[model samples]
Target: MGSLQTNELTLSYGKEPIISDLNLSVPEGKITVFIGSNGSGKSTILRSLARLLKPERGSVLLDGHEILKLSTKEVAKKLAILPQSPESPEGLTVYQLVKQGRYPHQSWLKQWSKEDEEAVKHALRATSMTDFHDRPVDALSGGQRQRAWIAMTLAQGTDTILLDEPTTYLDLSHQIDVLDLLFSLNRVEKRTIVMVLHDLNLACRYADHMVAVHDRNIYSQGAPEDIVTKKMVEDVFGLSCDIHMDPIFGTPLCVPHGKGRQLLKEKKFTEKQRKATLVPE
Candidate 1:
C-alpha cells in the first residue's frame, strides 16, 4: 500500500492562502472522505496532496519522500488522481481514453505491452464499462461517463487513487453507484481511496475515515460513528439537525431542522388533550 501525508503545509492560489499550517495522514488501504461546505478548502487539500498544486510553505510526502522532488513518472506509478469535471477530447472512445492511463508505463521501445492490455481490460471490468468500451465519452449518460473516467484511473494500476467530487451532477441513485464502486475498489483491491464529498450522510456511510474540514483546517476526523454528531453538524455546516442510524446500513443519518411544517410534541400535552386532538376513529 502507498502512504500520503502533508507536513505543516500552507497552500494558496496567489497572495491569499486557502490552507495554512495543515497536517494530515491518509490511512493506507482504506477509504478516506473529506467533507465540508463550499470554499472550505477540501478540494484544495486534495489537489495539494496529489501534487497538482504546489504548497507555499511545506511539502507533500508520498511514501515518506517529498512528492515534488520525485520524477513525474515515478509519482504516476504509485498514485492516480481524478480532478473534478475532467474533460476528454470530443469523440474519444472509452477504450481510447482508458488506454491513455498507461502513458507513464510506456516507452518508445515498448509502446504497447501485454501488461498494459491486461490492465485496461481489468479496469473496464472493474468499472463495469466492458460493454461500453467503444462508446464515445460524450454519448454516455452522466453515471456511465463518470464510470469511464474512474476506469481510466483504475487502468493506471496505482495503489493510491484520489478523486475530487466524483459524484457531482449525478442523481441520487448514480451517486450511490459511484460510491459503491469506490468502496469495492478499497475493499477488494486494497487501494488507498481518498475523495472530497459534499453529501454528509453518504460520506458517513462510505468513509472508513471521515475528515471534516472547517476554516481551512481539519475540525474532526475518525470513524463517522465516533466523530459525527448533532453538534459537529452544527459546527461544520451551521445547521441544527438530529442524527439517527440509517435503516439499511446503520450508518449515521442526519435529519436537518429547517423551515417547514413542524411535528408537535405529544409529551407536552395532557393525555385528554392529546386524545381530543387526534383524528376520530
Candidate 2:
C-alpha cells in the first residue's frame, strides 16, 4: 500500500476554483472517505487524485513523487481509480473488461501473459464476480455491474485505489456488501482505499479517515470521531443535528433535526391527547 498526499492542491474548472488550498494526506493501507453535499467538489478532488482532471495549481504526490509528472502508464501501475461513471465498450464481457486493467503493464510485443490471466481471475474471485465473468457487462444488475467495475480496478493490482460513490445505485443490502468487500480489501490485502461517500453514517462506519468538503474547500479532516461534530454537521451541511456514537459501528452518528410534517403531526397528536385527559373547567 502507498500513502497519497496532496500538498496545497488547488483545482478549478475554467478559472472558477472548485477546491482551493487543499492539503490532506491519505494514510497508507486504510479506508479514507470524503463526505460533502453535492457540488462540494468531492468528486473533483477524487478526479484530481486520479489525474483525470489536472490541478490548476499545486500538486498530487504519491509517495513523495509528483503524480502529474509521471507517465500515464506509470501512474496506472501505482494507482487505479473507479470513477462515479465509467463506461464500458458495448458488448464487452466481464472478463474482457477486467483484462483491460492490465493495459499499463502490456506492451506491443507482450500482450496477455500468464500473470495477467491470473490477476484477472483473482480479481473476479475477490469481488465474487467469477460466475459472471462470461456475461456481457450490460446484462448484469447494477450491483453486479459495480462489482465488476471494482474487479477491473482490482485487476490493476495497484497499491492505491480511488473510488467515487461506489454504492451509487445499490440497495441497502448491496451497499453494505460492497462496503464490506472494500473493508476487507483494506484489512486483508493492505490496499489503500479512498472514496467519496454521500451517506454520513456509512462514511463514519467504514472510513478510517474522513474529510469534509464544503463551500468549494475542505471544511475539516481527521478520524471520524475527532472531526464529525454537531457544529461540523451544521456548518458543512446546513443541517441541525445531534452527533452521537453509533451503537453498532462505534463511530459518530448524526441525527438530523428539521422542519417536517412528522414532527408537526406528532406534536399535534400529543396536544390532542393532553386536552382529552384535561378535567372540565
Candidate 3:
C-alpha cells in the first residue's frame, strides 16, 4: 500500500511560515480532501505533500522513507501531482502531453516500448479523450482541458495522486463532471486521491476523510459528518451556517446566514420543508 504522512511539518514562502508544525496522515485507497478559507495554506500543504515545496522543518515520509532522500524519478514512480491551473505549450496536443508522463520510465537504452504505448492509450481512454487525442490542449473547453491534464497524471501510473483545486474556474455542470470522474477513479481503480477544495458540500460528499485547515494548523480531521458542525463552521470559516442533511446524497449541506434575497418571511415553517411553498395554483 502507498502511504504518505508528515512529521511535524512546517512550510513558508519566505521567512514567515504559513503552515507550522502540523502532523497529517492520508488514508490509503480512499479520497481525502483538504478544505479551508482563502490564504489559509490549503494549497501550501498539498505542495509540501508532493515534495514540490521544501519543508522549513521536519520531514514528509512516503512509505516510511524520507521523501527528500529519494530521486525525482523514483518519487514520480510512486506519486503524481497536478498543480492548480496548469498550463501547456501553445500547440501541445493531448496525446503529446500524456506521453510526458512516461518520462520516469525512459532511459538511453530503452526508447519507446509497447508497454509505454499501452499506458498512453489507457490514459486517453480512461479520461474519454480518445477522440480528441490529436487535438491541441489550448483549443478545448475548460472541462475538456482539465480532463486532458488529468489524463497525463493517470498515464504516470501512480497509486497516489495529488491535485490542487481541481474544480476551479469551471461552471457548475463541469465541476460535477470532474468530481464524478475522480470518484470513479477512486472507486474503480482504487487510487489514492488527495485534493484541496473550496465547496464544502462537494467535499463532504466525496471525502472519506476531511482535513480542516485554519490558523496555521489543522482544526479538525475526521469523517465530514462528525467534524462539520455549526460551531466548526463559525470558528474555521468565520461564517454562521446551518448544517442539514442533503436530500439525495445524505451528506452535510451548509446554508450560510448571509445577506441574500429574503423571499421567505416566516421563520416558522414545517421541519420537512425549509423553504416557502404554495398549496394551490
Candidate 4:
C-alpha cells in the first residue's frame, strides 16, 4: 500500500492558520483515527490529505510524491475520501451513487469495463448494501445510508480511504455497525483507513493508531493504550475523565466525570442492578 504523510504542513482559512508545521504519517494497511474536540482541525487535516483543501505551506505527500503535483484523477485513483454526512443527489439510487466512484478510472478511450462493474459489486456486497442498491439513497435508514456512502468509497478501488466524522448522527447500534464494518475492512482487506472520530472510546476501540489533535496540531499519537490517558483526555477535551481498559476490546476507555447518580457508594452493584438503575422499566 502507498503511504500518506504530511511534512511541516500548514493549513489556513483565508489568512489565519489552523494547522501549522504538522508532520505525521498514516500507517499503511491499518486503521488510524484522529480524535479531538470541535475545531481542533481534525477535519482540516483530513481534507488536506485528500487534496480537498490546499495546504498553505509545506506539503502533503502520497506515496512519497507531493499530492498537489498529481492530477485529480491520479490522486483519486490512489485514494478516496468520504466527507462528513455525505449527501446524494435527489432521486439517486444506491447503485447509481456507487457507480460514480468509477469516474476516475473512465476516459473517452475506455468506458465502463468488467473491472468497474466488479468494483461496484464488491463494494455493495462488502458494505452489506447489495439489497439496497435499487433503493434511493435517502430512503434507507441512517446506518444503511452511511453504508451506501462507504460503498461508494470502496468502489473507488483505492489503496487508502479517508472519512471525516463518519459516525456523526448515527444511533448507538448503527454506530457500532458502521465501525465494525470499517474494522473488518481494515483487517480483511489490508486497506489503509483513516478517519476523524469525536467519540473517544469508539475511536480507541477501532483504531490501531490514534492521533489526538489539539491546539492547532497533533497532541499525541500511538497505539490507543500507549497514548490515551486521563491527562490526555483532560488536556485535549478540557474535561475530567477516567481512563480505563475496555474489558471486551482491551482498548483504552474514557469515562468522563459528570453529574449522575452515584450507585457505587458503599456497596458493589451487580450487572443486573446497574442495568435496572440505568434502564427504565
- In model 3, which residue pairs have backbone atoms overlapping below 3 Å? none
**Candidate 1, superposed: residue stretches over 4 Å from native:** 263-281
In angstroms, the error of model 3 at 98 is 0.9
lDDT of each: 0.92, 0.90, 0.92, 0.93
TM-score of each: 0.92, 0.92, 0.92, 0.92
lDDT of 1 by residue, 1-281 (tens): 88999999999998988888899999999999999889989999999988889999999999999999999999999999999999999999999999999998987788898999999999999999999999999999999999999999999999999999999999999999999999999999999999999999999999999999988788999999999999999999998999999999889999998432133333455557557777222
* lDDT preference between candidates 2 and 3, better one: 3
What RMSD does each model have against the real structure? 5.1, 4.8, 5.2, 4.6
Give the TM-score (vs. native) of candidate 4: 0.92
> Residue 104: error of model 2 in Å?
0.7
**How well does candidate 1 match the true structure in TM-score terms?**
0.92
Which numbered prediction scores highest in lDDT against the true structure?
4
At residue 87, give the lDDT of candidate 4: 88
lDDT value, candidate 3, whole model: 0.92
Sliding window of 10 residues with minimal summed lDDT for model 2:
272-281
List candidate 4 stretches off by more than 4 Å: 259-281
lDDT of 2 by residue, 189-247 (tens): 99999999999999999999999999878899989999999999988888898988999
Prediction 2 global C-alpha lDDT: 0.90
